[model samples]
Target: MIDAHIHLDQYDQTGIKEMINKWSENGIAGVVAVSTNLKSSYDILKLKQEYPNFIRAAIGHHPEEPPPNTRDLYELIDLVHQERKQLAGIGEIGLPTYKKEELYTKYSEEQFIDVLETFLRVAKKENLPVSLHAVHEEAKKALISLKKLKVELAHFHWLKASASTVNEIVSSGYFVSVTPEVCYRERDQLLVKQIPLEQLLIETDGPWQHGGPFSERQTTPLLLKEITTCLANILHIRYNELLEIICHNTKQLW
Candidate 1:
């Protein structure tokens, strides 16, 4: 099994190493350590250097942060391009939650759109897929922009939106990853029903969004089995079959 999205950089250094050892013990193949900021991108790169066979890095600024001005956008593009092949993809990037009062005050809608557009441009230039964090109307807009860029295999994790929107994303041939929270969240179950099996993937979004058989206290790649089990039930398929489909979808990104 492969945990398509994880924050190995966010875990304690020793603990993360142990987690990778455990993943090997449990037959997990690899993990993609995604960046939420420039620093995290470097951290992921360092981890990849140490465990090149088991970990892949992705570089990009998270959309929840304050919007970048034109100069800052260019700088971010340069940084992502510099690490393009060393990294698996460009991501953890997309629109911010408009309803969040703090994010709203930090960045206006127009500013957020501008920053997202910049990210899209970089993804296209580097010919890399992106992992998006979009929900509701924001999800719709992000999909539209990504479609225009002709980026295949984009992953949208923990998506919260209408079935029609999900259908649009699936039809676009993009992938959507289900997190462990799906084991308990009804909305996530509905999302599972909406997405086709071939276009679906599983993720932990770990060190955060914790749940399932592993200690509820902390999330790790070890808990990915719980997510895969839940996904098996939702898709009405055997566990191994679900794993095979998700693993294949993840590989398409690289």
Candidate 2:
């Protein structure tokens, strides 16, 4: 019951202990806590120190925003080297999809590609899995770089790609995750059907909102139960069966 991807640092700081306790009580084991920027990377790493068993940190610049400055990017790489043991992966990195046009106003698409390449190399150097944010056409673009760099362990978190692209990703032996959106979103359900049992992971991407059944609810790892139930139904398996398989899939990647 690990949440394969989440912006944990984005959650509220107050009463964090109570929140973790509740999640633990409900069978939520831990999370792959991803970073969105240099500061966020540090925050997640620090949180890992406090809750070593619960937080598997993945630090990197998120792609939908402007690229990191040279000094910050170098520092991030350095931080990764220093804390490689604590990291679950290099993550939340990819080319922008929703923000592509807006980001292009500030920096060229090539700049974003270059940044993603650098982070990919970092992940490769550390021999760590990556949690990617690339979706739509950008997912394919990220896949090209991963293949070029020969990164073997990757999780396309909350992936939104065509059927053909998903097949290619699955064939590459990388993992893909579904968020709680799978409970109500047909698109996510269809995405799950394309993924094999061994490569399927579940996440909440907590602190981010969802519509339908999850509307107005605070996103958290506990939502994994609902996601697991939905996944079980979609995959036509029993609840515990899907749980064990997903847990195994998560470990296989992270």
Candidate 3:
């Protein structure tokens, strides 16, 4: 199994080795270590070099942060282009949801749109899949931009969209990934039920924190077993069947 989205760069050297051992023990085949900035992109690439078989890099600037300077953005694009073949995709990119209150004031929504457009264009040009972060209304707008740019192979990670919007995303053939929240969050559980099997993928979204029973648990790929089990129950499929579909979906993305 593959963790379709995670910020592996956030983990330290010791944590990385521990994660690798856990993945091996848990039967996780690989992870898409998505990035949030130029430095993160570079770090994930280096990690990929060390564990080529277990890690795949997804390079992009996260929208929640202030937009990068022109020079920094240019450098990031150049680096991503140079390492395109080594990447699983361009991602951890999208418009900020209203929940990111500081971002709305610190970085204008217009500025956020511009940055997202740049990433969308880059993803389109490179013919790589994207791991998106847009949620709620932001998810709707990101979908619009993707369609406008004719960007294919998009995975909206931990997506929170209206039922109609989810239907639209699935109809358009884009993928949506669920996180551990699906085990307890009603919205995430509904999302799993609503999305088609072929379009469904699972992620940990680690090392981001979460609530519910997982409140005190360490967020790691090892938890995917429980997540997939929850999803299997929701989708009325066996654990192995759902896992096979999700694994195939991740392969289709790359």
Candidate 4:
């Protein structure tokens, strides 16, 4: 199975080789490693080169952090153009939620929106799918921008939005991902119910610690086994069948 979204670059290099080998032996097919910044993007691209068949790369500025400087933004755009053939998608981009209050101390919401829209335009022009972080109330704004720009493929990773918004996303044919939390979090379980199986993707969002059973565990694609198991039960499909469908869903996007 594919890990639909993860920050592979954030992992310590000490034993990632062994980690990947282990995950592969356990049945992991590939991962869509997403980037948080320009440097992260370059790192993911390099990883893609090393594991061409095992890593699908997506790159963009994550919205919860400080925006990239103008020069870096332009350079990132240029890099996308130069390496378009190598990228799987544009991602980790969307409106901020967890850091919006702190970010507003220096950057206005409008500024963030502009930067996000700029990247959205780039994604549309590049004709690549998008991996987004938009959640809660801000998800609506991000959806508006995506529709306005006519981006055809997008995955709303770890989405948290109103029932109406979630339905709208499904109706719009956008994909939504659930993390390992679905095993213990009611919110995520309910979310899985809201999205059609065809639009559902599973991710670990690794290196971002989770609570409950995942507490203190170093997140990795290996956790996808538990996530897939939980989802199969929730969706009431056979384990192998659900795995096949979700794998197809991930492939249908990136």
Candidate 5:
């Protein structure tokens, strides 16, 4: 099994290391540690070096941050080109749901779109896959743009989009990751129903959005099997079959 996406830098280093070691012990192959900023992207690179076979890195500026400068985007592109084989994709990048007034207080929507466009261009140039964070209308727009790019794979996590948009995503062959939150949240379950099993992948999105019957604490990749179980129940498929599909998707992207 593979944890398609996670934030290794967000967890306690020692705990994360131990947890990953345990995952290896449990027969998990590898994980893609994504970046939400420049520093974290570099950190992901270092992690890839440390765990060459077990960790893959994806570099991009997340929507939560102010849009990056052109120089920075160029540097990121250069890094991806130089380290193409080591990277899973360009990710954790897209538009936010904040209104224009709120967005301008930190960064303009135009700037966010610009950064997204830049990242899309880089992803196309590198012929790399991408993971997105946009929801609803924004997600729709991102999907339209991605279809025009050279993306090989696309994973949309924790989606909160309209049914039409979700349908479009599924039809377009993009994958959607269901987190453990599905076990406890009706909204996530609704999302699970909307996505087909072939396009569905399970994720932890660990250290954030943690829920379920387990400990009410931070999430980790170890809990991915729980998500798979929830998905299997919802999709009415065997657990192993669902696991195989997710593992295949992870390999296709990373």
Candidate 6:
């Protein structure tokens, strides 16, 4: 199975090395390591090099925190271009929603859009897929920008939007990923029923904990085994069947 989104750079190097060693044994084929800043982008690239066959690198700046000075943001864009061949895509980038008011007051909405647009433009020019973080109304705004830029390969990671917005994203032929929350949340299960298997992907959003049995546990891709089982049960399909399809979807994206 492929873990389509994870922040491997956020983990300790020793832990990551151990994780890599067990990739084959754990039934993990590949992982898309996404970055949240320029430094993280560099770290992801290095990890990809360290485990070329198991990790795909996606470099970008996340939107939740106050963004770096505009100059630094563009420098990361330049980094994307410079390392295009070694990179899998541009991602973990989008407008903020959960922290919207605070971020908007800090960076201003226009400034945030400017940063998002720069990444979108770079993604378009590079012909790379983008892993997005927009939710609610911000998801709508992101769709507009993607349509405006004519970006075909986009992944909306851990997305939560209205039915109409989801239809728009599906019809546009973009991808949306679900997390382990689908194992427990009604909202996420509803999304599984609504989206087609071809357009759907599975992720752990690991290193970021969730509730229930996962509350006190350390997040890891190994948890995907249970997630896949739960998703297959929800979709009323066999486990291996769903696993194959999810892996295919990941390959199609990156």
**Worst lDDT window (10 residues) for model 2?**
245-254
| TM-score of candidate 2 against the unseen true structure | 0.98
Per-candidate Cα lDDT values, in order, are 0.80, 0.91, 0.88, 0.92, 0.80, 0.88
lDDT of 5 by residue, 160-235 (tens): 8888999889888888887777888888889889887777777777677574585565677778878888888887
Local accuracy of candidate 3 as per-residue lDDT tens digits, 1-254: 99999999887777688769878787999999999998888889999999998988899999878888889889988987899889889988998775479876666888888888898888888888999998898889998999999998899999999999998899999999999999999989888878889998899999888789899998888888989999888878999988999999998896
Q: Between candidates 3 and 5, name the one with more favorable TM-score.
A: 3
- TM of each candidate vs. truth: 0.92, 0.98, 0.96, 0.98, 0.92, 0.97
lDDT of 1 by residue, 1-254 (tens): 77888878888897777778888899889987788876777788888888999987777778877765666557667877776668788878888875447888766787777777777787777777788989888899998888776766588877888899998999998888888888888889988998888888888888884645444457777777888888888778999887888888888875
Structure candidate 1, residue pairs in collision: none
lDDT of 4 by residue, 1-254 (tens): 99999999998877778888988999999999999998998999998998898999998999988999999899889988999999999988998899988999999999888988999899999888999999999989999998998987989999999999999899999999999999999998998999988999999999889889999798988899889889888889899999999999999999
Ranking by lDDT: 4, 2, 6, 3, 5, 1
What's model 4's overall lDDT? 0.92
List of clashing residue pairs for candidate 4? none
Q: Which portions of model 2 miss their true places by more than 4 Å?
A: none
Q: What is the Cα-based TM-score of model 4?
A: 0.98
**What's the count of clashing pairs in each model shown?**
0, 0, 0, 0, 0, 0
Best candidate according to lDDT: 4
State the local distance difference test value for candidate 1.
0.80
Clashes of 5: 0
lDDT of 1 at 156: 89
Residue 108 displacement in candidate 6 (angstroms) = 1.4
Q: Is candidate 1 or candidate 3 better by lDDT?
A: 3
